[model samples]
Structures are given as structure tokens and as C-alpha cells.
Target: MIAVDPEEGRVRLSTAATEDRELWQFLKGLQKGEILSGTVASIESFGVFVALDDGPRHPVFSGVGFITFPELSWRRFEDPSEVVEVGQRVSCEFLQFDTRNGEARLSLRALQPDPFATFADDTEVGQTLSGRVTKLLPFGAFVQVADGIEGLVHLSELARTPVETPEEVVQVGDQVSIVVMEIDVERRRLLLSLRHA
Candidate 1:
């Protein structure tokens, strides 16, 4: 089931298990921290199962792995299956090894560099950064400062004009200028505003 192509990011699973024994042997050969590609076989309440894409037809899977539901605030896809379907291909970073059970802990979200880490290296409070609005919520909008890093401009900080819903003053996909008010490294939260602009 596992497959690999030059254009794809990592490992991928394009078919069902044709040789479970050989696939099992290949899965045992992989080491931790390896990047993998695969297809969505099935999703359960606990996690997602993916079949590998290389010869020998291995079975590699990824779990939500870190954090809980309330912390993510993901607005959509109440179920993991809703977001990743039965045939969709995915890429993940191998994190933990569990040879005893043949299950490895994988991460899809943490694959890329952390945004806060980069922002902290190059930015400071009172600085202004131009960014695009990625998501809108009642509290604020999430602005993408880089590929994975985002800053939030609260409703009260959107503008000097009276505020109601975050969307009323700012809409998603609008590129705006924002002043960095506070950089809470401990919390990984950036406080931003457009009032001065």
C-alpha cells in the first residue's frame, strides 16, 4: 500500500495491503524522526490510520499526537475523518517508536518550523509587520506573519473605531498593517493592533 513519487513530499500509501508480511518487515526497518507519506485508510475517535506507499506495503499511522480539542480552536472538522478522508494522501514526521505494538507516534502539525520561534528571533515590541488575515473570530483575527507563525489582533485592537464583531472591522484575506504591542514568548501569543495605522 505504501508508495513514493518524486513530486510528493514523503511516503504515501496508494493501495490496500497486498503483502502484509513484507510491509510489516519494512515498517520495522524505519527509524524515528523519519518523514513519511501515506493514504488515509480509516479514522477512529482516537486517531487516524494510514497505509504506507512504498513497496512491501507497510502500515504507518499518525495520531492527533499533541494537545487537546479545546486548545486548538479549529472551527471546523469536528471529527478527524471529516478533515482527512479515506483516500486523501498525507505527510507526517515520525516522532515516537513503539516496536512492541508496531505503532509510531506521528505529528502533522509540528512538521514545519514554529512561527513564534522565528518571530522572536527577528521581531520586537513596537515594531510593525505587514501580514495577511487568515482567520476571523469574535475575539480577533489570526494574521500569518510567515508560513506557520500567526499573530492575533483582538477586537478592541482592530481599530480606533468602535468595535462590534471582528469581521465588521476586518475581513479574512485582507492584507493589513499591524503594530506589535506585546510579544508574550511564554504563552507564544503576539498582541497586535491597527489603531496606530
Candidate 2:
């Protein structure tokens, strides 16, 4: 029980694991950054559910662990299936206990190496790198510099001549040379210039 109004004869019950002493204790004992192994039980548009190999079963869900789509991988993907599938065995870092949802929030990407950091370590401003235009927008074009790393070339940086759109200079899948303008490792972003290429 969490709250109650004696005069109104109303009571509010909590769904926290506190009601299940063993589960509550287990959840409390968990520390962030701990690795947890589990099997993918179900996949949803928002996240994936995992049936933990060690924890007690969830009262309502098929799994007691959950991983958000962004936590599944460092690479950009259109769907969760691109990163993981149901029944796949996975080792994820425990992010936190989702008290509201009664599940352990996990991150599969945390256990993997960050491609951006590696790219940044080897790259410097003004260094030219060969890349393929992966996407084009009105403001700029997105170029894939590495396997999972993409850099943006703003319209003003596309060329010396004024351009209205990225398509005026480059199109998707077009291999192009670009100079690194900025590598914001903290923000995990890269700004490039086709004009200086």
C-alpha cells in the first residue's frame, strides 16, 4: 500500500516489487553495470523483452528484463529486428530497474565497443576521408565514413557555389570525398565539408 484517504475511504496500491520480498531484494541487490544474461522472449516496436536466465519470473510479462531499441546497438537501424531477434541469447549490461514497469532495463550496446570513439581517435579536423552519401536532406547530406559512423555535410559546405539542396551536389550511394570539419565525440556527431574535399 502506498497511499490512502481515510475520510474518502480510498486506497492506492503500489505495483512495486516490494510486495514480492524475494524479487524486491533481488532488484535492490542489483548494481548498475552488472552483466545479465537472458534470452530474447519477445520484440516490440518500442523495445525487446528478455527472459532472464537467473531472475525470478515476471508476474505479468513473458520476461523480467527489457531492452530499449536504442540500447540494442550503436548503429542506426530501421527496425529492432536489425539488431536482435526473438529467442537469441544475449548478454546485456544492467542499466537500471524500471520500477514503474517492474523490469530490469538493459543495454546490449554497453557491452560492445563504440565505433564512434574509435573513429574519432583516428580522425582529425581537416583530414579528408572517402565516404558514401547514405542520405540526402534539404539542409545537407549524410555520408557514411565508417561502418556505423555517419557525418553530415551542410548545404553551405557542399561546394563553393550556392546550392539549394544536397541533391544538387550529391545523391544517396554516391561515393564522395569529404574533409572533417568537426568531430564531436561527446555528442557522437561529425560535421564534414565536401567543398574542402
Candidate 3:
């Protein structure tokens, strides 16, 4: 078993309850939707491991939290260091948990309202937006305006200009300005267009 020591501010691994009480307290408070403040202990390909305020010399339990790629905070840094420095204090809300395994799925992105929600709040049918292609599928392309929001440009909407497949014109990472022809709230679909705009 891995044990951590948080007696002061230094972290080390020691199999002692008196030494690791801080981590235990932090872990105990992990409830769905609970926001916990932490420190970025280290980063990895899969995700970053945070040291909770609950404490310990070594990380409470290594490899406990994640910031799924899409949920990562935008940073100007050429690398992860530009935003979150090692030992930097960070706070995030829990998005999910795997009870079978003691892991917490967390998000730094959830702190703000979703851009899709903002788009719905600000616009209506006939409003226009400048969109950039993010993903290209066989059937259509996904265009995004603000971060975290995207609209699908189906093959049928690519034109009167269409010769057949979505790839004939739309390409991944292309910028196309489109109008919000329709927004289906119940289905979370946005009927987007370039030709219509």
C-alpha cells in the first residue's frame, strides 16, 4: 500500500495514519459535484495528479484526478507550464467518479458556463456567426465559433454547390462563417450553413 506524509508541507511516503491524515480527510470529502482545491503535483500523458489540501508528503494517492483533453484550460504557454506551474494551487469541480476504482474525473473547464449555452442565450434563428471547422466527418463537418461550442454542417447544407461527399468541400481545420438556420434544443442540434449566410 502507498502511504503519504503531510505533517508539515513536505511530502513523503510513510505507512502511518498520523502522518497521512490530511490526505484521508481530503479523500473522505470527495462527493459528486463537490469542488475541491488542490495543487498540481505533476503532469502526465493521461492527466495531471493533484495534491489535495487534505495533504501528505507524497501525493495522497497517486494518479487520482484527470482533466480529459477537452476539459483542459486554455493557456498561452507553449507548454503546460505557461498556465499551471508545478506546485501551483489549482481548484476544480468533480465531473465523475469510478467507485470501483478510487479515481475522480475532474474538470477545470466546468467553472464557466458552456459556450453552447451562451450561444443559445444570445442568438436565434437568422443570426450569423463566424465558425471554424474543428472536425470533419464523412457525413459533415463540425464547426465551432467560441471555445467548447460546435455546429455540424451536414452534407446537404454544404451547398447547392455539393457534388456528393462532405469532403468534396469541407475540410478539417478550415474556417467558414455560417448562419444559425435552426437550433434544436431537445436534440442539441444546430442546423448550420455557409451557403445560407
Q: Number of clashes in every candidate structure?
A: 11, 0, 6
Give lDDT per model, in order: 0.64, 0.89, 0.66
Alpha-carbon TM-score of each model against the true structure: 0.52, 0.89, 0.65
Q: How many backbone clashes are present in model 2?
A: 0
Best by TM-score: 2
Better of 1 and 3 by TM-score: 3
> Which tens-of-lDDT digit does each residue in 1-197 have in candidate 1?
13455686676654333334654466567777787776766665556666656523333434212222222222224567545677787777666644433554566655655657777889988898898998998888988766557788988888898788888877889999998888887788878888865
Q: State the displacement of the C-alpha of residue 142, model 2, in Å, after optimal TM-score superposition.
A: 0.2
Ranking by lDDT: 2, 3, 1
How far does residue 117 in candidate 3 sit from its true spot (Å)? Answer: 1.1
lDDT of 2: 0.89
Cα-based RMSD of the predictions, in order?
A: 10.4, 5.9, 7.8
Q: After superposition, how far is residue 11 of candidate 1 from its true place, in Å?
A: 29
Residue 128, model 1: Cα distance from true site in angstroms: 0.4
Model 2: what TM-score?
Answer: 0.89
